[model samples]
Target: MHRGFFGLLALGLTFAVPAAAADNLKITGDETVVTIETDDGVVDITRQKTEAALIGGVLQPMVPVPGVTPVGELEVLDALKTKSAKVVDMRTLEWRTKSTIPGSIHIPYTEVAMRLNELGCSGSQGAWDCANADKMIAFCNGPACPQSPTAIKAMAREGYPPEKIFYYRGGMQDWVVLGLTVAEDMF
Candidate 1:
């Protein structure tokens, strides 16, 4: 019974020690050092030290694409008000059915490739038409989502000029968060 109790204690200590140590390791370290212990050997990650940059003297990690134009909710609302731009909702049909921006066109990302011609652009004439009067802006769920980018890329590949394509990366989440009006009826 003494030997069994000691074995159980050892087992508990083996598991608890690592977890307790891991909790103490700060993720904000200049060198994100990681130590891994395996049955084979102990692996030290000291060489993986990364220099962290300070934003205003505090650590601020860089985003994948910095300075991305965040189409603000106010901009979208203004677009709707002024009727200066065509807002296309790239949300899925189910999402569109639930709610969307008023005066926005519904075009699901899945169907964008097939319905490229319906965008009413003259760029299909075999040259990029950045000057086309029918400019289009795409929006999806939000900045973290990629559906709007996919739709924009599809439009560009289908002869729509890149200049005419605007991405509203802030998307529906920002619109709703800003308390902007939403149309429950599909357009």
Candidate 2:
């Protein structure tokens, strides 16, 4: 009985060990690959590959969204420090309450088009200062999410200048990932 139990334990470890190791995904070039090692051999599993045409035999970042500037954590931090940007949170009320980038105002994506003035743009042109730059920026969950991008488009439809609008593509995901401060109560 003891010999059979030990044999089964060993068999289980063989399968479990490789699975745990393979959970470490590798990103090489534009593809996501999972490499697993077992007694028999190594197995390569390709989960996804980004589709992009090689330009001059070299890879480049994916095509950017038209009329949107992607801002990183550093840029957002700078903008907050200077008070240069009117940061808007495109997340829903639930997500905002849980955690959000500090200093971003709560503006659900659905209301952005009509609430341009409320967000900071003053006039019918969505103008704060005609002579100066636009400071309105919006963000939501992250890259895989569309809330922020949708809000930006809504602003554009409301006659907001594309150049004035900014998109914090990383949003809450990147903010927390970088250990940035999150505001729970205030917007």
Candidate 3:
């Protein structure tokens, strides 16, 4: 009788130990580590969630564009050929180094404010030579990326006409997906 009781207790502990360890792995708002038992093998899941942006007392991810329609790849390419538009590649340094659209200018989001003058827009004269010379389209990584919108806002604040600014939300990812040619050298 005593031996049978001990054997049952040992069997219960074998299953309970793994359950407790699985529960211990979870950490909220930081990194969640979970052990999943599968038919084939055990799998571990670790995910780190990003913080949300606050807007009007509601938390949300930063949107790339508010209410503007993103121009198509063909449209942008045609504009480039006609000299009717210019593209400002707002991708990060690491991303830009990998690949970029041909003839696109490099203006990382963080540097847009300081480099506004380089766009050939004369702040002193209150004229946007680059933007006015042709439509100005800004792009970064992709639709989920927030850099391009920030760049557009910076340009607008610097007196680049809003009407002339077109946000290319599709960005470099879309450009490459469409099999567009990427320039190895920076413009």
Candidate 4:
């Protein structure tokens, strides 16, 4: 029994290590940076790790809403590349003016629900009908920032379909640390 158990454990580790390596997003090596063209200009997106402060404000929950899917850099990038969903910057204009994901749109947490029509929903400010809302990926400052979470929760409460929402919890913090493309002038 013990020998069989040890054998299984070794096999599991063997597979696990390779899988982990394949999925590793760690920033290393001298040639790891990448670049992408944006509306503003060509920007370098790096996988080079930095010691800069990347997170601030109050931390938010992992899953902001029960049915909303949480995503990371790769997922967010794929969506932007494919144009499969709208990437929204939930931070206020002040925060957005500093820097933001290249292709994302602005919709402050305070105004998201009131502006549901922009996401394909209809009705009015108080009466939202979001049955036909578009697929959206929401993000803000960073893990500690509550803007995205606040916007996501409000969106859910306002009857926006949770299944259609994707939360990028790392927000701008992770985006910058990872050396991803950011648009400085969002106006």
Candidate 5:
């Protein structure tokens, strides 16, 4: 092997570290460890075990966008119950047809920036005044999915306050895994 490859291995760069605030998203006693028998030996792989893994997609970092608060199931529920926040499902229509978090509004990532008015921002698409933008929680298929992250960045670029944005990185994968409420008729 090349010396650089050995150096990379020695640096222990196998997995990406999830950003902080992940504790709020973990379900009780969730086990992420996986055991596999390799040709050379037995391997125990831990981390990168979100439900997104089962569905087959690249595992995303716990924090997609810096300065955005990352939240979980409980936080999502509380926010919905209190009517203190708007939970947005940033997936495309096809994905959303399967299932979604209850009370979350559908706002495909492709159109979020143009739809800021629906979020309480005034003015037109290019000249938005988001001073009154609502506090929003954005999510998609799972941490592996980029829809919400894309929407989030667009919102931020359009002057949506990062403080008013919360990211539910676990998304539908974690929500379904936890057996929380799912909304099937959300078009």
Candidate 6:
């Protein structure tokens, strides 16, 4: 390998290190060891961990958006079968044109708050009348997607019923990954 590659590897990635909070970190090892107090417990960051942190950051997992339930493919499948739920797409215009969940309504994340009336979500005089719809599920790309979460939050802020709103976190990525049927967006 070229010497430049080694030099590039040695370049450290920056991470936001918060000051010691209510949690106390106990350091027992040498200068190389870094102890961080997490909710689980104090974890030691060794040389290996430091490298990993640079690549992946503090090793945190995907957390669901607050005030919304994270659902998977099977759950969405059941929802579709029940015919009581209304699955909405929160992706962009370009991405939505490629593919989307079959029978899902297209309401981009950016328009969620404004389009609530068009969805007839009980607040405005929309022709759709969401009152007849059981659960209004929203989804985007996948678990890492922020569109659906942001839309769901917008709905909540608009006083949409928490019980009626659901978040399908798996989204189109998981839907395609699991070989589920997809509908090409005609709109």
Top of the candidates by TM-score: 5
Ten-residue stretch with the least lDDT total in model 2? 53-62
Q: Count the backbone clashes (under 3 Å) in each candidate.
A: 0, 0, 0, 2, 0, 0
Report the C-alpha displacement of residue 186, candidate 5, in angstroms. Answer: 1.8
lDDT (Cα) of model 6? 0.64
Q: Whole-model Cα lDDT per candidate?
A: 0.61, 0.64, 0.63, 0.80, 0.79, 0.64
Q: What is the TM-score of each candidate against the true structure?
A: 0.57, 0.61, 0.58, 0.71, 0.71, 0.60
lDDT of 2 by residue, 96-150 (tens): 8887877777889887765677755666544442234367677777655567776
Name the lDDT value of residue 147 in candidate 2.
Answer: 73
Candidate 3 residue-wise lDDT, 1-187, digit = tens: 5546347656673322333333332243333455788654676654322232111111112333343346878777976788677788886777777788888888898887666666656554334444532367788776556678877776676666666767776777677777789887463
- Give all candidate RMSDs, comma-separated: 14.6, 12.1, 13.6, 14.5, 11.5, 11.9
Misplaced by over 4 Å in model 4 are: 1-51
Q: Which residue pairs in model 1 clash with each other?
A: none
TM-score of 5: 0.71
Candidate 4 lDDT tens digits, 65-172: 899999999999998999889999999898899999998999999998789999999998768999899999999987767788888888888899999999998889
CA error at residue 115 for candidate 1, angstroms: 2.5
Output the lDDT of residue 151, model 6: 81
For candidate 4, what is the lDDT? 0.80
lDDT tens readout by residue for model 1, 116-150? 55566544433444345366677877654567776
Better of 1 and 5 by TM-score: 5
- Candidate 5 residues 22-97, lDDT tens each? 3223222343444578554666554534434424444566666678899998899999999899999999998888
> In angstroms, how far off is 123's CA in candidate 5?
1.4
Top-lDDT structure, candidate number: 4
